[model samples]
Target: MKTKRFSLRTLLLTAVLTVVLTAGVLLGAAWLLLGRAGVSMAETMVLINTLFVGEHDIQTATDQALDSLITGLGDRWSYYMDADSYQQQIQRRSNSYVGIGVTVTYLEEGVLHIEAVTAGGPAETAGLQAGEEITAVDGTALTAENISEATSLIQGEEGTQVTLTVRGTDGTEREVTVTRSQIDESPAEGELLSDGTGLVTIRNFNSRCAEDAIAAVDSLVEQGAQRLVFDVRNNGGGYVSELTDLLDHLLPEGTIFRQRSNFGWETTVTSDAQCVELPMAVLVNGNTYSAAEFFAAQLQEMDWGVIVGEPTFGKGFSQQTFPLASGGAVNLSTARYFTGEGVSLIGTGLTLDQEVALTEEQAAALSAGTLDPSEDPQLQAAIELLRETEEPS
Candidate 1:
């Protein structure tokens, strides 16, 4: 009866082992397909438990194994997220965060510059205004190199208070304390320049980004925008749906996006007939990525606009989030994307029609959101090209 019980226990362990497979791939396929690889993850796991050195939890070992496997794929854009981290990532993608009611940018002066104060939010209540620099947060001096650290210093549980040292544009400094709250902020914004050119800056392509970008452009036209400049500098891309939708808003009837997956699947997204038809340009920088780079490429390729600034740091892969049986997920690069012209942007990013480099001071001011439109060389270059493109009216 003891021998019978051992055999039953082994069968149960082998059955349970298959649960460790993620995306319904990897180990199970390894066990069945090589005609098998990993020499049976079950056998490996059982051996680790019975003979491996040191303390190890089976669940943790499984998680690490999956993590390592994904990391081994050598795609910097892909990775595994544990359940808690995955939830946090989802919250970030939703474009909401717990913070004082202010939007900030890291200046080259090693401080955070207040770009916009949310009306009636904690920061505004504490008298924080746009153009002020956050010199320090909770006594830790803010720095461009550690923007994330400074951001974390200021954010806390809702109703918690954080102290900040702020400097106004005039150089006057003061310390203020403000309570934090949940803030839903979209970084996409539009402003009509003094010369009637609409300036739309999209910092991210997440959440309601498509809606926000479309609205910004339409509102600018309503305000008598004679031309348009889209600033996507420092933009790291987000959802594909958002990118395509925004492209549809700006580009006339044509293919806006093309993609191919590992399984030999291909697809394309086309825009409608209606589109914004103003003289336009897309401002980009090296930090521009993924959908942002593609946005500029499509415009330049279709003769709708010119690209200004340094070439984009190209991204050819599109990722898909695959949930693991482990309750976490892996963001795997599942598809290769191409420009609207069916050109890949992997090694060669979008070529700039005008390669405008920022001066040290100009870059600092740009980061602080304090750079005047009249003072930005890249914007000026784009405006010049657009002026040449303007029809006699």
Candidate 2:
């Protein structure tokens, strides 16, 4: 009697397994048929996941599939970020975080190059200089595929230490250990020049950038500044909302820019009643991009300022970040923005009223904060133009 009962139980389990297998096959076939009938990509993904087999984490698989789909679009500006990376991006735009502060760029040759080091940050305190190459983090090799992972390893709770192997421009390597700490970024910096010009250098349009710029201008005015010079050299740009707010303060009431979405929807952004009525000159370079480029273009179009330096790095499209259910996010280029003159700065950047290219030596000196304004041809040209306006005709 016991043997008969055991055989019956085995038969029941076999029948259940067979039914599951058959159901999976049917679901897969249905998915194929729906694809042929022109089903949406989202629906197709759901069908594929419903019939997936073998050992796998469903969430991870879904994330990978979504990443693949976005990659297939062939849009360089659109990308998917994991949960951790998404959070880090948010922190960066907010201009604060806990990490060894350094901005890095991953080269096509798989080298991790330090682009900029924050003043007074842990990276700067550890004697890590810009233009150096980072070879490894905590002894693990750095590669294009692992750059984000390496960054994650470098960041940790405050008071944690991260060891990095760095290579100098001359190929000498050294290991440096840096401690993580909270960083509050001051994006806009101001100074009153000797010639009574207010020099407001906007590093990027991060959070509170507009407020900082206003305060900077106000302080410089109180110090007897007769003119303003807005420098955005090497500024890669940040939040668009912040950019618009900055423009609202600097430009008179008029059309600022027009945004056209993928679905043919359009929206026009106009300046508010508030404005800064001051003689201004904007300084830009090859690295001035996105919102920075727009800032220059708007001033040039309105005849509000004289634009100097090299042509900007053109990038007119604006990306919107969509948060995923898995805590990750995707930044997709949702719209292409055009200037008030109905010109798009996508491939061809903004044309400067006066062009001045900085030599390599001068650029290095400028980065080191040792470039004399009298020796800086671009700045000198701007100062001369502003001073000319001050003279009686």
Candidate 3:
């Protein structure tokens, strides 16, 4: 899964540094119509253009202006994306993208580590595996400061091949050429463990995600797994409607969530009386965000499941991406959301039934899909709790 784009985090933490491509023109318009503040800004631009010691690009300056304009809003959820990035975001929403299909994390040394290799993706087909290092993209060796730039270089027009210098887990290094294709990633996966435990990993909440997750749950039940565990770790969230549908499938008739805007208006999403009521648990980590976090919070709030793992840094607002004529776009936080209990999850996050923090080695193994249940404290605890708690009478 190519997690994180410019985040499902609608892919979130990758910040967009550039802004409205037409800001240069917008600046002139602002200068013409506005009063003293606009004049001051225009004066600064003029001074920089004439007297600056170094090369001063007016386009870059205008981009900075628009970027700063959004930053001034003081909302971390709001961000700007250039044209290409915005387009990638749209593709990701449809559960597809043009890339080699690997999820990466930056090491402390500024190196890129491949945490996941999408099954059957270009990277996987090219022999890339999890727990390896993408030392370089093409000939540009990855460095700490160049992580973002390196990632950008890895993405290109579909069908173009990108050379990746990969370091295997055995410590041997080799260069692998992977064709960048349109990787259509599945949003969910399911497995029935030997213990009759159904594991449904909902990687995202995007297009058709609920349908897939529901299918997985049903398949697991057909396999005779009475208890279930839903994995939403590292999930960045997606469409609220999808989240609502999934919640409705698992939870009984009730309010799934509530959306409130700054304008004092509110909207509520409710579920019917029908639901899947198996003894359940939601597995999470710090990267579990937005709709994913809300999914866990709702389950915990309604006593539908036990929330296991670390608490999420709470977020109350939901964002919507607005595209610009210049091909760029801005993802703005449009409304604050609440759990079904009508409470904000903006502080310590959802109540944890059991907080299981994995050791460094364990975390790495889990990321690489090598962590066995015996070695996974979170999974073991969740399964144990499900078995001992018994189904609700």
Candidate 4:
């Protein structure tokens, strides 16, 4: 057998072809098992852009891609916001904004309903009230699709005016022009009840929540409040640091909550030496969630307070916002938190010492400010509970 000697050039070509084939096979395997062997996000993005058929600018495409990526995580707490929405979120977290300071919700009736009006804000100053429906913004009809646009229309440079057509609960409609200005919302409000119980309603745990809470509690104490009722009914929750700080003022030196991340890293937030020693009760409802739920759970776990009202909203996951280079942001569910006693409030919320459910009619009447406290079984129950503690045993 005559062995044909291959030339150096042919051998080199054959070796190069072998190397290329091997690399292709490895890459194919990697692409098949991309979840195990992570693929580069940049590479995926390039592939997406090359194949996407929708009409999208680079920014919109990237934003949508990021949003879709987060949505794929299948966690409701994880979300993506565009630049404008991200800025609005930051403003909300800061408890300050240059808008009319009215939070609105789109109703099924194609009306923009004012959910809450910031105290001393342009909306409140303009006599806007919660539950009022906004029909139009500056002559433009506000639909569910364009409610966000209407919100943008309402917000402008300080000193600018935005006209809103509002319908009152009594079916009266009128147009009011409100001048936008900087509004600072207090995170907590407190007052001493007639029975010497301090009623502190925490709006949300923003950055200034702890400070506001301290001031409110101190003021209530100065007004001769002997006990406290923390009303976190509608509070959806905010920064974890703010919650921890507020807890430090209320709880003695102990672990407030424990956070466990996906990587198995655990963190325990502890209270400081300073604490508010008043006998307390926490008021909660279906809207009470996240840090608010954590607050009630911690207090109940420590035997510091009696929890009242219905079961909580049961949000145990903690979210973290990551700012993108495009000025947008992504909020991701980074961890799940538990009470100091190792109780998780994810789906099954904290059971209250007293469970009181408000009838739909009563709730509607309460929202309309027509339901008397005498008829509000939940509030009455809390007051009775606290007052019983006040009475001599």
Candidate 5:
């Protein structure tokens, strides 16, 4: 006799389980937000009533709940674009969205920090600068949940207008009116270092990034680059395929990674023929994540090179995009990935061989030329790693 097919109840339980484990919400508003699609509060209470009967089976009920909810939405990207997805999107595209172009992030103080103002964009055109506090957008309080929504609200068709209520670093608050328009985001930037080390900062990994990076590397190599410092600072991450193709040039032909799903199934992604075996150092910090971590992990795993600076942001889950009838998508973590050496960088990030920390004052000092990159602990450590492994010219 064969086993019976999974029921809708089972599907909903699976979804609930996935959401609870992934988001770690046990109850209250967070739980309501997570399971609002299908499982009503009453239904949840009913399931809780059965907790005693379903001991080990509680997980099945939760997963099934989540499955039912997800199936109803029918969206692929609309489910929840977690931090990892946000990082990937930012680093994958060079084309800036149309809006009062400003990079805003939540700081430790719970205030919206004006991280960057793209030059020539509406925000900069309206005199918006970095280090300002965005208090509100059209009078709505700015919060982490609404940050993306506010940005989207500001972005509109070309020739649109947006008013921002911002408080400067001096605690002065005011409203500024600005028109929205297209802003360009550059992907690949390269500079020649003093020691003939080509320093390339690939801000994103969009389409054609592999070619762009190769060209940049070739230009640096031609410029007498004996070593390379690939700076991915503040880089969130992007296309896994793009990163894999890039690693093809940086890692030897072999299994680079493995992806395991909820069902305990595994798939391996291997490297291509071409590989770069130069003296290289990858710079990562608390923000270097997703595909960035992927590159760093494999490089460190194979002992091909060194990963310096600080621990990575550690986003090891893989999302599968499913399209919805509403022209939206739901991108959920369908699988977890590991390095060739079985290192998990999920909640735990990549451990750099050399650890370094930076103070605000030190960063300012470095920016003002009082400190040097060669003297910066992180850079110095990376240089030392590269020098120690250098090949005789």
Candidate 6:
């Protein structure tokens, strides 16, 4: 009876081992099949290696490898973006992201500076001031580059909450919580001053920018504004079509700007609409780039407006995005644009008609909310030029 019990136990052990081996083989075969059936080789190998080596988590290892590889490419501008990041960038390009609608800039010292607050945006409503330094975003350190990335990340679906840490010019850090909202991002906002002058600020050339600009100009005209100041400071850029429409309303019947590709002088945009024949001034600065520069250069070439402020940002290269199968895209510079007078503004930016320099005290005073550029001496200079050019009809 004891011999029979030992034999039975041996038989049971053999059956258990056989089942385990069979299951292992089946799993290996399934993995191989998946590899053959269009699974990413890197992902498949990572899984298999993890199973065999029993070292690291497969997903973590894969992400780390990808991050390392992308960073090792030695291009600071090139980065590995996940699905959320990719979606956010696409939304920003399409002008549909929900944020506080504050344009930001990075100073040379890695400080995240607020450039402008869009009218009717959450930032404007929150009373965020320009020249304010962002100290942190949701506990993340706010370096210039990190702040830019964080801003994009903080901007989410409508009604989301974004906690920001701000350090004002007074050097005091405070926490500010802002709820994201969909604000009307009209590219232009204008009104007639008491002196019959149009005070217009061009935000960006988005989808409805030109229409908004025309409406602003028309409203100012109805309000008896005879002179115009087109503010394009801190304007990044947007739709080329919208820019064309804007120039058409401001420029005479002639070539506005020229685009040169490898094919050599591919296309020239012209003004089809009647010009708004008024004494105009285009405001530009170092932050003004791309479509803003295009508009400024067009007006400058046609002698339609006097450009005031600092030299424009020399970003004349045009980029186009191509989607990839992995749900990501590449923004590659494909062509270069030039002014209507055949001047390349890529490396050499457009010079201003008047160079306005602010003293350190003036800059500090502006940061402290003491000085407003709308009432600035520089802007007053532009308005005074309009006053001098005012002729009785």
Q: What is the Cα-based lDDT of residue 340 in candidate 1?
A: 72
The best candidate in terms of lDDT = 3
Q: After superposition, how far is residue 342 of candidate 1 from its true place, in Å?
A: 1.0
| lDDT tens readout by residue for model 6, 280-390 | 988777768789888888787888888777777577777665565656555555677777776777667887788775566654543343556555665777787767777
Error of 1 at 377 (Å): 1.0
**Candidate 1 lDDT, 1-393, residue by residue in tens:** 344646877888877776554636775566676454356666787788889998767777787887898899899989998765576578678888777877677778688878667766788889888878899888888776777567668767998989999998899999999998887877588999989999999988889989998899999999999999999987888999999999898889999899998888889999999999898899998889988898898998889999999877779999998887778999999999987779998989988888999997777567656789999999999999889888877
lDDT of 3 by residue, 1-393 (tens): 674434344323333213343676677777778767868876887788788898666666766676797888999889887776778788888998899988888886767889988878898899998889988888888888888666788899988999989898999999999999988888998999888889898888999899999999989988898799999987889999999999999999898899988788999999899888789999999989999999999998888899999878888899999988667889999999998879888987778899999998888877766778767889889999888899555
Candidates by lDDT, descending order: 3, 1, 2, 4, 6, 5
Candidate 1, clashing residue pairs? 33-36
Higher-scoring candidate on TM-score, 3 or 5: 3
TM-scores of the candidates are 0.76, 0.82, 0.83, 0.84, 0.70, 0.71
C-alpha root-mean-square deviation, each candidate: 6.8, 8.2, 13.6, 5.7, 11.8, 11.5
lDDT of 5 by residue, 317-361 (tens): 876665443333456768888887677886678878888877876
Candidate 6 clashing pairs, residues 3+ apart or interchain: none
Judged by whole-model lDDT over C-alpha atoms, candidate 4 comes out at: 0.84
Clashes, model 2: 0
Q: Give candidate 1 regions above 4 Å deviation.
A: 1-43, 48-67, 100-156, 162-178
Deviation of model 6 at 156, angstroms = 3.3
Q: 298 in model 2: Cα distance from truth in Å?
A: 0.5
lDDT of 2 by residue, 318-367 (tens): 99999998999999989999987788987889888789989998886666
Which pairs clash in model 2?
Answer: none
Q: Residue 308 error for model 5, in Å?
A: 1.1
- Which candidate model has the greater TM-score, 2 or 5? 2
lDDT of prediction 6: 0.73
